[model samples]
Every structure is written in structure tokens, then in C-alpha cells.
Target chain A: MSHDLDWIAADWGSTRLRLWAMAADGTRLAERSSQPERAPRTPAEFETILRALAGDWLERTGTIVACGMLGAREGWVEVPYRPVPCAVTPAALTRAPVAAADTRPTLSLHVVSGLSQATPPDVMRGEETQIAGFLAKNDGWDGVICLPGTHTKWAHVSAGEVVSFQTFMTGELFALLSEQSVLRHGVAEAGWDADAFADALSDTISRPEKLAGKLFALRGGHLLDDLDPATARARLSGLLIGAELAAAKPYWLGQNMALIGSDTVAHPYAEGLAAQGVTVLRADADDMTLAGLRAAHAQLAGA
Target chain B: MSHDLDWIAADWGSTRLRLWAMAADGTRLAERSSQPERAPRTPAEFETILRALAGDWLERTGTIVACGMLGAREGWVEVPYRPVPCAVTPAALTRAPVAAADTRPTLSLHVVSGLSQATPPDVMRGEETQIAGFLAKNDGWDGVICLPGTHTKWAHVSAGEVVSFQTFMTGELFALLSEQSVLRHGVAEAGWDADAFADALSDTISRPEKLAGKLFALRGGHLLDDLDPATARARLSGLLIGAELAAAKPYWLGQNMALIGSDTVAHPYAEGLAAQGVTVLRADADDMTLAGLRAAHAQLAGA
Candidate 1:
């Protein structure tokens, strides 16, 4: 709880909450944490938890500027989304003026708004703002910036703002298909075969048209005669990833792409896109999000 | 029961069993049925059920020519698979003699051999002989024939034998994806939109690469937002069918494809293929299998 702090920021999602205290120079002075918004805690309970984690600093600092799911309607505090085609600056964030429970109502707080894409209404919760933060840091970047996670975001970025993006339920589908479907019989317990995965990716992308039918080739090639479950499992994985690549190709057209995420999440795709004649720059995820958050906080403080 | 009958023919699968009494001229004189070979009936119990269904005819006919899963290792009787790249014919299906009952050795029987495709080693039980019978009835006809059921088979036919084929695990995947996946969220409890299905087929075939990505769009369009479940379910259904169409395309290139199965099974695909600019001819399942069986029986009889 440093009195000299200029701002506080948080990135909230379905499973985790991260809070940061910053100096005017945007150096993180301290950190706080809590379970995700879905945690079995009421807004008051979560607020107490957040205060317990960083409340002392907040009392001393007298203000905080937070972003992410923590600011959503269902969050510890409700913040409505700012509509699309807006920049991801602190100014772009949707906010709520609130008086904290203190001897004197001293803390002022604001939350960022999620972004949406279409009439079909593809929207992001906390990550949209985080992405906007990333754009804020890397000015003049133009191309696709993929934020891969459970729900992978493939976005087109230009002139320091997210222009357009699509979401692929890749990790979730992989979990469901591999662990739940009858195809579960073919998956390996722990072992991974890079060759098999590459083969599958190639098989899927090369004949994207035949991707689904080829899935059965796993069972067909394994049971009732062909018994190659590993290949089959690999092939299924490939089909999904290949399908993602195909859907993502349009956004990456004629631009340099930066992949910002864990290598485990982004490497295969980088490998896949490389094969497709696309140059991809790989960056560390924590660095990107934190930098973006700092940039957003600094931009807001400056404003 | 016809005293003049020479033998009885049987078809067995995972869930159903069918039998018929035929004269030398292939005139079907009587009908009988029972639970499929997968049922818990012992050899004696199978005989009892068969006799109960057509015992009198068997007594008069004195012989049986049984096929399908009835001959698999796990069935009432084990009939080994005949390797592929060979004519699927009655003579090819001829097996070692088996007594209808240990106590009644006079009742003799022969079982049919199933067919197998190497490389990936896909095998078909019972249906290969039926297909052989079909080829015998319409000798020299070459094209694609679909045997649709819970698992639909699309086989490429040439020179009175199956040249190559691929199976669409469509039916099973549909059941698994709809009933089991998180997709169960917006799916209709039990209704399908034909218009939605038609659109799915078109989109699937047209943008085969987008198949996997579109599935996520189901939950993404609905959960993180609002969506029509029926249309969403239809979209899921279309995504799958589209994938199947993409996989099945290579086999149908520049060929006249005929769907040989029950009307209920073939019609949707017939409509789907029509939309894809492919003309399809339909054939009756019973007649085709009977024609196939009779051809096999006649071939073995001549030998």
C-alpha cells in the first residue's frame, strides 16, 4: 500500500484474477490476486478479498483503475461494455464512479469495457481490454496478433488498435473431443507425437475439404480392422488445428503476424502457419499483457 | 414352411437379424427374424429362436446360407473374413461345414466371409457378401454405392467388385456431438430444420476449411451472447455433414454415384449431393442384399 502509487489495474477472467499496483513510471510496485469471477463469492465477499489482498495499498493510494471480468456486470463490480470500433485506452473503458467503504469515501475506481465484432455479436470479456492494452503498447503494428488460450483469439491489428478478430474454441473442443467422444479410445494418455501432429495438420489443411471424413478414418483405420489409434488421435487434433488455420487465414493475409502467448499454445500454430507461407513473430505472453496493462494505466493517468 | 425349399438365408447386424427360405429358383418361400447376433442367445438358443421364427421351414429346407455379423467371431457362429482385392462373391464366402445343432448333425450350414480393405485396414462384416450379390445381380455396373445406417458407408465400385471406399462416421459423431458435447446447450431437444440443414450442407461443402472453426461459433454465438438454439444445432449438424461431404468428394470425382440403402437413410444425402451438383440413384436395401445373397448362393451351388 504505497501512498506514492499512481494507479491500480487488474485483469479478470473465468478462472483467475490478477491485480497490480503501479508507480507513475508504470513500474509494478506490488501485486494482489484472487480466484476468478466464477468463484463462489458475492460482490461484497470478493471486494473484501480484493481489499484483503491489496486493500491497504488502495486505502493509502485513495484510487484504482481496474479492467477485465472483475468489472463485468457479474463481477465484483458491474461495468457495462463500451461498444466496438473504439480504442482500448482508459478513455475507451466503460466506468462506474464508486465510493469505497472507508473512514472517508476516498477510493475512485473505473473498469474497462469488453469489445464485440458482429451482428452475430461475438464479444470478449476481459481479454478484449487486455488486447487493447497490447495495441496501446505496440504502436504502428499491423497484422494478426494471436492471443492463444482456452478460447484462442485471432485478431487483426493495425495502427495500435484491434481492427477485427475471430475466436476459436480450439482448446475447449480439443478437451471435449479428446476426453468425451468415442474418439477418446484413440488418444494417448500422456505421450505426444510431433510427427503425428504435423502429419495430421498437413492432412487437414491440404485437404481441408476432407477433414471431417478423415476423422472416421481414425476408427476405420483402427477398429473393424485398422488399429492405429495414435495416428487417429493425432489426425483428429490436426483436423481441429487445421480448421482453425483455415478460418484464420483471411485475417493474416498480406501482413506480418505476431503470436503472443505460451509456446505450448502458440507454437503449433506458428509451425502450421509457417508451412502456409506466413511469417510469424513469437513473443512472450506475460510480457505482452503486463506491458499492455501498464500502457493502458499510464495512458489513463496521463489523460 | 415350403417342403421344396433348398436353404435359408440370414442377415445379422449389431441390432437386427433377418432370415428367408428360398427355393432353387431363388423364390423366397418364408420369412423369419430374431434379435441380432449380438444378443445374449447361446448357439442352441439361437437355433431355438430361429426355429421359433422359421423352424418348420428349416426342417423342410434342410440347409441354411447365413451371412453378416452372424459369422463374426463374437456371433452365434464365427465366419472368418475373406481378404479384399478379391471378388466378393458367394463362392468366396463358402466356409467349413457347421452342424445346426450338435444333436441334429443332419442340418448343415455355410457362412459368408466379410470383406476387408488394407492400407488402413477397414473391414465390413456381412455387407461385403451382400454387395457381391448386388454386383452379381447388376453385373458390370460400376459406380459409388452407399450403405447408410447408424454408420453410413460410401463405397466405390468397379469391375463387379469394390475398388476403394471411405466410411463417414457421420451418424455416430452426430449422436456423440449432439447428445454429449457442450453443444447440447442450444440444440433442439429432437427437431431438425431442413432449411438449416440445407444451408449447412452448402456452407460445409463450399468452405470445407471453415468446418471446425464454425463449431466454436456455435457456443461463441450463443453463450458469450444470444442465439437461436435450433439454428445453432442446425449449424452444428451442417458443420459435421459438410465435413463428411468434403471427405467423400475425392471418391465421387467424375463418377456416377448410386446410393444403395433404405430410403430413409439415402434421401438426405441424395438431396445433399444434388445440391453439390452430383446426381444420385437409389436402390432398395432388401432387394439389393437379396440379389447379392442369391448370386453368392448360386455361385457356391455351381461350384
Candidate 2:
């Protein structure tokens, strides 16, 4: 198909690189992804990887707005994190210095700096872009935004800026314990038991300290009582999410909260919250990423 | 040195086999260990492995008292778990059936049954033998005994029997997070910060739900503010143990607790509990294992 690409919106993470071709009006023209052998060790490598992934879509003097681990210190260029209590807008994005070698002369790359907090010391990379996208659509969201994933984040945004945030290794812990730990013996690869999930959620939220013991019980329950694998998997997830909710009570309690992530990941957060009588709105993670990148591109154009 | 071996006391776990030669009066004659290529798959395999490890020590007729995973369903013999609230004595031990093959008619083997609680549905193999050893040393002592290891256990003992207990995967979680998870980047393999550990213990105990976030903070703290790896490791250990202490409050609070394990592992638990104003007595785990096995031998003789 003949196309006139205006700019590129990219989310470059540690393991994968995703790029979206956009028109001048911020409409997506095309999308592509490539698994980099490893994280680019230098800016030159990043350019090579980026060009290889989106060489066809790059137009002369086109802008490329990227977010995620690409902005990390070990990424293409070390972009300093913007302290929290500040809005994540296109104006806040940092430009990466192109390599001296002539490669993609037409591509001007810009990476959105992640957000950081001094007290308690926490940080987020790509999620900031998702937050920016959610805020761009909502305009006046003054509550909590939960981004659940490998490292789930519970962020408190107010007056268009992230006031405070916390991250839980809940997702990673779940993956490791279920797939690698002794619990692996009892939990199935894929299954769902809503009742078990809910019960475990309630049980954990009410007494999160029981998490370690409860985790072992998933294995024991199966061995002793024939607790099905599906129920075991669901309960494991529920226990983790429940513990997270209990810890993040200060973030979601009595506050309007929205979940911004993939449907598969965010659904459990929604369910867990709803079980506690808390209603939450949901937003697609990819849509938000695109919107946030587009917003950054627009800021670059206006500049 | 030539030795007169009366009996053998062993703690055969999944990965390692530990054997202790005992005189008729319960004096340890010798000790040895070997890593089984894999977990013994059947009764015959267990017999083969056992004979290989201690064949030279066998007299004309000898009793082998064993504990730990040897009694597990997958171990030498599938011995039924003795429900808690009962004394762990030699009489409580189960004898594994001798295979008809006449390899070593001089050896009669017995494996101690582990303790199981139905309410929380927790099980322990080796720790029960240690508990039995501790109780044998201090009969009529009624309080809590904490055994720290791969799975830390807190048992409530009364009137020479285990009333109830809970198990925490604190050690395993620490190992997994520090060596396998993202936190591994921030934590050092060795070194410690006493102050950092104490602070984290207090923080997690007060707000355990914050565990997931606090754990992530270790990595963030290092990235943002150059948190030293030693302190990070100590803080991680403290956070896990603190969360455990919070959940095990019902067991440790207002109870005379003793820590039974190696000095290296039990010291932290001792320090943590001491920080909470609870002084705990320490018992060497190996010594306890030998004593418990000796007590079991005495019971076998009486029986």
C-alpha cells in the first residue's frame, strides 16, 4: 500500500521493539515488531535496530518519538527521570543525540524520560507514557491509575501530575512461584476459577501476612484435598493481587481509580477491586502508548 | 579410628543424605553425607542409596532411624503424617518394610513421620525431627519454636507435643528474589547492614501489605540514590522476615520462643525477634537432629 508516513511512535523495551507509523494528523499508518537479540548496548546499536524495524516507514526528516527502557541509562541514551508531582507531557520528553555515523539521517529520535520519586525511591519507564495517554484522554483525572504487568504499578495522579506511586513485583512473583517454585507442581499453565480467586483475594486482603503460608497451602491443598489446578492457579493470582490491594489500600481507598493496561492483565485488578466494592474504569495499554507517543510527537512538531 | 556402631540416625532430604552413627548409649560415632544423583524414585532405590552410604557401618544387626523426606510419599517409604498435638518420639516413628531381596538382613530401617496440620494444611519433614529433638531436651516446656530454613516453621508446643504450627517460605523467597528476580541486580550475595535490617523489619511488620512495593524499592533505591548492595540484601532479608513475624504474631507474641537452626540462619531471626523485645533461645539444628534421633532410638528399644 502506498503511504506517506509522518513520524514514528515506538515503545522499545528490554526484550522487544514495537514501532507504529503515524500520519501528520496522529493517525497510525502501520505497525511492526522485532525481537532484538538483546538490549541494544549502545546508541549506535539502537539506531541500527530501530532502522531495521522501521526503515521502510521512515520519511526524510521524520520525527521518531520513543518511550520505555530505551530511555533507561542502559538504553539508547540515558534520559534523566523527571521527578514526580510533574505532568508527563510531550514538552517533558528528552531528545537523544544521534550517532556521528551517517545512518538514518532522516530520523530524529526523541525518548520520553521516565518518572521518579525521591521519598521511598520508586521509578517507572514506559508506564509513564501510558499514564500520559490516559491523562491526555481524561484531561482531569485526579485519582489512582493502576498499570498491572510484570512489575505492577499503583500510581496516584492529581492535578495532571503523578503525586506518588508504588510498584509491586506481584506479577513477577506470581509467574516465578507458579512456574518455578514448588507450587508449580499443583498450578496449571492456564486456568480460571473465579470463586477461588475471590475467596483468596478476600482471605489475603484481610490478612496479607498469611501470604507465604497461603502460597505453600496452594501446593498442600492440592496434595491433601485434591484442590484442582485451575482453582490453585486462580487462588495464587488472587492471593498476590489481594496482597497488592491490601498494601496499596492507601492509593485506591476512597479514590476514583482507573486501570490502564492490557485487558488480560488489567481484568484481574478490576475484579479484585470490584470485589472490595470499588469500581474502576479501564483503558487499553497499547492505545494509551500510541496516544502518549502521538502527544509527544505533537509537542516536538510544535517546538 | 575403629568404631563400634550401635545404630544409625539419618535425615534424608530430597537432595542430600545425612547419616549419623550412634553407640548403644546414643553417642554419635561418626557422620557422613552424599548428594544422591537424584531423588530416590522408589523403595528399592532408597534402599540402594541407603546401603551405599552406610554399608560399612552396619553390624550383625542394626537399627536405622531416619527422618525428613525419607518418609514422604516419594521417599523411601510413604509413611502417613502423624497429626499434630502428639509427642514426636521413637514410638511415633514408622518402620519401612524390608525388601525381600537378601542384600543386608542386618539392617532394619525406620523413618519418622512428619507432622501435619489439617486446618492450615501445612507439612514439614525435617523440622519435625528437630522439634522432637528440642522437646526431648526440654520436656514439659510449652511455647513456640521457630525453625528457620528453606521453609521457616513456627510451632506451638505444649506438654511435650506440637499443638499447631505454620510454615513460611521466607528463606526460599529470599533466595529466589535475591538470586533470580530483578531485585538480584541490586542485592549483593554477602555482607549485611544491621541498622538497615532492623529498620526494614520494623517497617514491614507495621505494614506488610507494603512488602511488594518495599521489595521493588530496593532496586529503585539503588538506581535512584545508590543504595549499597550489602544494605539492600540485608533490607530484603529483614523485609521478608518482618512480614513473617507479623503473620506469625499469634505464635510468637507473649510466648517463649526458641530458634532451632544453624547459627548463620537462626541469628537473623534471633536479632529480629530481639528487636521486638522478645528474647529467644538458640539450639543448634544438627545437635537437635541427633538428639531427636537418639530419643527415637531409645523409644525403639523400649518398644
Candidate 3:
């Protein structure tokens, strides 16, 4: 069983680590994860953690390709960001300095560098790998790809390279506002109101500046009109997303667009964009991440 | 000292009750306050709380003029909101039914009703009184009175009546984003950078819709460029306020403006407005609330 594993793919983020045992042909054999008390502070620590998670599968020398925050300056090895207008393939992967004194000769590690745009000064790590996966499938697709999550990103991929990208804190803002702000008092923990969401999305898209005032009205409406908490929650979600869409109009306006995120998270974006008469293709976030890692592995092997 | 007191000017809000012992001519003789565990649920409870705070000032039967959330529907008694395009005086004040069984016949209480806008369906419980106070001092002033706070209000006054007004959740959003959102990690708990504030304010005002994206940059800049927390805090503040100014352009453009809020809270607004070439007069928020309540008392007494 251990011999079936030929390499490893890992997406190590700020808070969690997810690893996949991959065959030489890019087939995933098994998966595992670890909740490190804290992220590794050095290459040795990273090696130790990696060995602990995939040691059994490493019956022979194998290549390990990693992405995500692991490439950040604070990660195991600081990989400089690759300026954009570049392909999202492993050809762009930057190798972190290997531990010269590695005791485990059966392991080789390489971390992928993230993409950065100097003009707008935007940066992305794990999402770049996902974009690579998306482009791998689309092959020469020229348009926009929106990855909605904690920090939703919109990347313009043209001629098989990511031209430019922008990010919005829409998800994080919604979480904080719904859980910590005054709106927390009125927003329900769970439920959906499609009409409320659509109405609020339209209202915010039309007058994004009113966002500041409209937020308070969410609470006031609940108090005065007995607005259902679920509806309030949906409306709040719509408002934040709508504001984002308004700002990101430059990216999605008159372009072929696709959304790469969890079904639940990406549904609203689809609905919102559709309401504006824009068709958006939805793809699974995890699948894209896996495909991205596989594409990186293929490039690394070929190189 | 208590004998000189003629009437009590009270500003009872959601959290605290503030009362000023005033002479018949509006001379503030003394002040007192109380923090009720919960807001009053009935007229009798309101009277009880009022007596506890200023029973000593009521040597003889004296009228009490109250404003703020005490007049809210959930407060002492449901006071109907007086529609806009009217004077912010006792003429719009609604009398809450006095306790007929008051053991102490030395107190008569009247709560001022807040102003509401039907077109936009907005309501204000406390700021109207502040507007009244502002108009009291600046009689015949036909411009904007910006009361900056948790829910900042920009009211247009002409010929002693509030012509129209708008409220922005600028202050509240600033507080929530800086303290609760991911930006909290990068923002300073306390500090200021005037230049950073000015730049961010200008940036957001020019591209208000970019607010969703610019917010994340606060954290990114801190991580990438070693931005000082103090500067980050100020920039965050400027961004939120700048967005507000952009939305409130119609209210302040080519108009004289006065700011009514605490020094710390109002300073940023004054600075932002000043940057836009609008000179704003600043007044103490507490003083304005008092003056507004006093004006209401004068009107009630005349009636």
C-alpha cells in the first residue's frame, strides 16, 4: 500500500494543513491532515511535521510539492511572489532552500510561489494553484475567474497566463459583521430568504455608498418591522456581496466568468451575477485545488 | 442649591440616563445620572428611574423635558416620530402619560419625539434634539448640521426647521471593522497618523466602491510593507469616513456645515471635510444635547 504512493501534495494554510499522497501519474492514493499547535517556524520543523504525516507512505525517495501560506514570508521557507502576467503552472514554482542536513534522504520538498500584481499591489498564494488547476482544464481560456472565500479573489486569465487580479474582503466582512457587530443581534444564525437577498443585492449594487447607512437599517428594520432574522441574514449577505460586485464590475463586466468556491459560498455570487444578466460557471473549490496541485506536480516532474 | 432648580432637562438613552437641574430660564444648576440594568418597559418605570436620578432637584412640582431613546417605541412610552420639514422643538414633543398615582406630585415629565423621514424610511431618536440645540444657537442658519457618532446624522436646517437629513453608520463600521474584523489583527488599538488618514480618506472618497477591497489591503500592507499599526488604524478610519463623505456629497457640497460630536469623534469628520475645502464649525456633543433639551423645555414651558 505504501509503495503505491509516489509523491506528496500539500496545501498548508495559516490555520490548517491538508496533505495528499499522490501516485507518480498524478493519481491521489490517500489523504491526511494535521492541526499544528502553530505553523512551522523553520524548514526543519516543517520537515518534521511532513515526515510525521506522510512518513509511512514515503517507502522510497519522493517529491513533495506544497502551496498556500507555506510560501508566505512567515512560512517554512520564504518564497518570493512571482509578478503576474505569467502562467499558473509549476514552471513558476520557486524552490525553498532544502535542509542541508536532512536525516530523511527519502524526501524532497518544493514549495510553489504565489502571484502578485505590482500595479494594484495584490497577492495570492493557494488560490494561484487553484487558478492553475482551472486553467489546466480550460486550456487557453481568456476571461475572469472569481474564487470566493475568506478573501475572495478575481483573476484575469488571458492567453494561458494570469494577467491581473483583485481581491475583496467580502466573506470576512460578512462573518465579522454577522457575528460581532450590532447586526449580530438581528441576523439569524441559519436560514435563507431569496427575495430579500435579491432585493438587497440590487439595492447595494445600485447605491454601494449607502452601505454604511443600510447596515444599521438591518437592525432598525428588525426592531421596527419585525424582520425575520433569516431574511436579515440573507439581506446582509447580499449587501456585502453586492458591494463587492459593484467594485469588481471592472472584472466581470462583459467577460466570460467562472466561480471557484464551495457550492454554498459561490451560489450567491452566481445568483447575483445572473440577476445582472451575466452567466457564471460554478466549479468546486476542493477539486480545483487538487487539480492545481496535480498540474504543479506534472510541471515539476517534466522539468 | 436644589431650590434654585426649576425644571429637569433629561437625555435618557438606551444605556444611561443624564439629567440636568435647570432654572426656569434654562440655567443648568446641577447634573446627575443613572445606569439602569435594563431600559424602562413602562411609563411608571421611567418615572421611578427619573425620580431616583433627580428627585432631589424637584423641591416643588416642576416639569421635566426628556429626549433621546427614552422616547423610542421600546422606551418609557411610544412617542410617535414627527415627520421631517418641521421644527425640532417641544411643539413636536409628545407627552408620556404621567403616573396618576405618583406619591411625589413634584415631577411632571415630557419626552421629545424623534424625527423620521418617510421617503427613505429612516428614524433618529437622539440626534434630532442635538439638531434642535444647533439651530437654537445658529438661528436662521440654512445648511447642514453633522452629528457624528455611532450613527452619524447629517441634517439640513432652514428657517428653524429641519428640512431633510441622512444618517451614516460610519462611526459604527469603523469601530466594528477595526475591533472585530481580520483588519483587527493589523490595526492599532490606539494611535493616529494624520497623513495616512488623509491619503486613505481621499482614496476611498474617489473610489468608494473599492471599500471592500481596500479594507483587505490594510492587513496586506501591514504584512508586506511593515505598515505601522497607528497608520493602519488611521487609514482604516479615513477609509470608512471617506466612503461616508462620498455618499453624503449631496448634503455637504456647497453648504456651510457644523459638526456636533465629542472632540475625538468629530475631529476626523472635520478634518475630512476640511480636506474637501469645506470649513466646518465644531461643537461639543454633550453641550448640544443639553442645549437641544433646554430648547425643548423652553418650548414646553411656553406651551
Candidate 4:
């Protein structure tokens, strides 16, 4: 069973840890994850999780390349951020230090470095690996790539390098507003209205200053006018994304664009960008993440 | 102790219940509150809290004019909101019903109705009372009364009537971002940087759409540039408030403006307005509440 495995590819974010057992030809032989609910914390936890998922294959594995918050200060090891206006492929993968008394003492564990932008002072972890996967496939393709999540990032790509980028806390704001703020009482727990989203997106895009005022109106609309929960939910998403689009006009206005992810968060950006007359290419986030990890694994052989 | 008391003034909000023993001549004989940390919930709790604060005065009171979310649908009693384009004095104060078997079943309790704007879909619970107080003192003051708080309101007063209004979730957003969002890591629990705030305020106000991006930069700045926590805290506040000011430009651009509250929230609005060349008159929030209650009390005597 371990003969088919060559290296392990992992994407460890704050809320989840995914592991892929890979062959030398970059084919995934097996896949496992600690899902979003029960991700690892300390180095010991990471080791424990890894063994539980791929104990049979790891001892026979030649190398392991992990990406995302696994390299954060609070993670297994602190990997330095590679400042951008640089290549998507990590310049170096630091060997993640483990305890000396570890059972798999000779484990060749390495973590990818995240990217940093100086002027806007933005940083991205897991997304960089996804971007690397994207660049590896597209070669010299140049434009912008948008990866949407809690902390959504918009990167300017040129000549195979992440030239510059910006980030928006849009997803996080939407969650907090819908679940924690006074508006929570008015917005329904589950539902979505595309029309409401389009209207709200157009409203905020035209007048982004009205963002705060519009947020309260959602509650008022629900209480006084009996706004549908679905409408309120979609409008909340629309408003935040609209504000983001308006701000990111410089990045996506007339630029060729690709939106990563097929989830709810990415759907709106697709709709929002399409409304603005942009023909956006959509990519599956999971595939890109795996491809990114595979690209790193293949690079080690050439080096 | 109850001899001088004629009416009882109360301002019951989501987080606090304040009580003021009043004389027929509109004087506040004594004042007390439940404070922000622990407000009342059910009708029984409200009564218990009232007795704890002013047990003696309540027995001799002729009128108990209470204001704020105490009248909310979730409150003890749902005192209907007085739709705007109406006089500052509530159209009516619905008597809050006490349980038949209660200790003071005949208690003359009344909760002031908040104001509602139809077109914009806005509502003000406690700020309406503060506005009434301001109107009572200023006579025919006609302009915008900017009340700063979790849900800050800007009311348009014309000949004592609340012509129309808008609400900004500015303070609430600032709190959410500074204390709960990723930016919380960069911002200190307490501190202010006026210069940093001023710059961010100007930045967002000029380009309101740049808000979501600027927010992420606060965290990024702290990480990359060793940005001061105070600066991050102030910047978070400034960006939110700046977006609000931009939205409220039509209300305060060349109109007579008065800002209610003397605390952290109000200070920034005053400075932001002042920087825009508006000499904003400042007023204490508590003083206005009592005055507003007195105005309501005085009106009761006339009726």
C-alpha cells in the first residue's frame, strides 16, 4: 500500500487540515482531512493528526509539502513570507521543525511560505499555493485572480508573478453581521435571494458610503415591511460584496479575471463581475489547491 | 425621601435601565441607573430593577415617563413607534401594564414611543428622547442632531418635528472590527491616535469604496510595519466613521449641526465635522435624556 505513495501534499488552514497521499507522477493515491471543525493546533496535535491519517504511507514517503496557516507563527513552524512582485512558486520550503523524540524522526516535512504585499500591506497563506497551481497550469497567463473566503484576496498577476494584491474582510463581515449584530434578529439563518442581491450590489456599488446606512435598513425593512428572510440574507451578502467590488474597481475594472471557488461566497463575485460586463473564468478551489501542492512536489525533484 | 418626587423618568435600553425621580416643576430630584453592563429583560425584571433604584420615589410619582428599547417588540411592552414627520414630543406614551397581582399593580408606568422614518426605513429607540430634550432646550433649532452610539442616528429637526432621519451602524461596526474581527489582533483594547484617525477618516471619506480594503490593511500594517496598536484602533474607528460621514454629507455639509455624547464615539464625529469646517455644538447624552423626559412630563401637564 505504501509503495504507491511518493510524497504527501497538505493544505492546513486555521479551521481545517487536508492531506493527500501522492505518487511520483503527481497522482493522488489517497486523501484525508480533519475537516473544518476539528483542525490541529500545536505541533504535537499536527503530528498526531498526520499519523492517524497517513501513518502507513508517511514512513515510506520521501518528502511532504504543506501549505497555508501551517506555516503561521502559531502553527507547527514559522515560515517567512516571501514578498511579492515575485514568482508564484515558493523560493524555498522551510523544513518544519519537529520534536527530537518524535517517532518518525527522519520525516522530511516542509511548509510553503506565504506571500506579502508591501504598499497595501496585505498577506496571504493558503491562497498562494492555489495561485502557484494556477500559474503552473496557465504558464505566462497574466491578469487578476480572485480567491474568495473569509479573507478574500484579489491578486494582480503578470508574467507568472503575483505582481500585487488587495484583500477584503467581506466574508467575515457578512458572517458577523448576519450572526452577531442586531441585524441578526431580522436576517434569516438560511436562505438566499439573487434579485435582492443584485439590487443591493448595484446600490452599494453606486454609493458605497451608504453601506452602513443600508445595513440598518435591512433590519428596519424586515421589522416594518416584513422583508423575506431570503431577501435579507442575500442583500447582506450583496451589500458587503458590492462595497468590495467598488473598492476593487482598480483591480477588476477592465482586467481579465478568474474567480476561484464554486461555493456561495464565490457565486456572488461571479454574478457581480458578470453584471459589470466582465467575462470571468471560474475554477474549482479544491483542485487548484491540490494542483498547487503537486506543483511544489514536482519542483523538489528538478531542484 | 419620596416627598419631592412627582414624576419618574426612565431610559431603558438594551444594556441598561436609568431612572430619575422628578418634581412637577420638571426638576430631577435624584437620578440612578442599572448601568451598561446589566440592563433588565422581562417586565418583572424591570419592576424589580426600578424598585431597587428608586423604591421610595415611585410610590409618590404621578407619571413615569420611560423611554428607549424598553418599548421595543422584544421589550416589556411594544409601544408603537411614532412615525416621523411628527413633533419631537411623542404622539403618545403607552402605559406599560403591570401584572394584576404585582406589588404595585396601579403603578402609573409609561414607555415613550421611538421614532420611525418610512421612506428610508429607519428607527430610533432612545435617541428620539434625546432629540426631544435637545428640541425642548433649543426651541426651533432646525438641522441635524447627530447622536453617536452603537446605532448612531442623525435626525432632521424642523420646528420641533423630526422631519426625517437616517441611521449609521458606524459605532457598531467599529466595535465589531476592533474587538471581534482580525483587526482586533492589531488594535489595542484602549487608546487613540488622532493623527492616524484623521488620515483614515479623510481617506475613506474621499473614497468611501476603499473601506473594506483599508480595514484588512490595518492588520497587515501592524504585522509588516510595526504599526502602533493605538494607530490601528484609531484607524478602525476613523474608517467606519469616515464612511458614515461620507454617507451623511447631505445632512451636515452646510447645515447647523449638534453632536450628542461626550465620550469616545462622539469626539471623533466632532473632529471629523470640525475638520470639514463645521462648528459642531456638543451636548452631554445623559443631560439630554433627562431634559427630553422633562419635556415629555411638561407636555403631560399641558394635556
Number of the top lDDT candidate: 2
Name model 4 segments beyond 4 Å from true.
A1-3, A35-41, A52-62, B1-3, B35-41, B56-63
Q: Looking at candidate 2, what is the lDDT of residue B294?
A: 83
Per-prediction DockQ comes to: 0.35, 0.68, 0.45, 0.80
TM-score per candidate: 0.71, 0.93, 0.82, 0.95
Q: What does the lDDT come to for candidate 4?
A: 0.84
Q: How high is the CA lDDT of each candidate model?
A: 0.68, 0.86, 0.83, 0.84
TM-score of chain A of each: 0.81, 0.95, 0.92, 0.94
For model 1, state the Cα shift of residue B145 in Å.
0.8
Please tell me which model should have the higher TM-score, number 1 or number 3: 3
Instruction: Put the candidates in DockQ order, highest first.
Output: 4, 2, 3, 1
The CAPRI-style docking tier of model 1 reads acceptable
Once fitted onto the true fold, the runs of candidate 2 whose alpha carbons sit more than 4 angstroms away are: A1-3, A35-52, A58-63, A98-107, B1-3, B36-52, B58-63, B97-107
**RMSD in angstroms between candidate 2 and the native structure over all alpha carbons:** 2.7
**Which candidate number maximizes TM-score?**
4
Better of 3 and 4 by DockQ: 4
Best by DockQ: 4
On lDDT, the stronger of 3 and 4 is 4
Model 3: docking quality category: acceptable
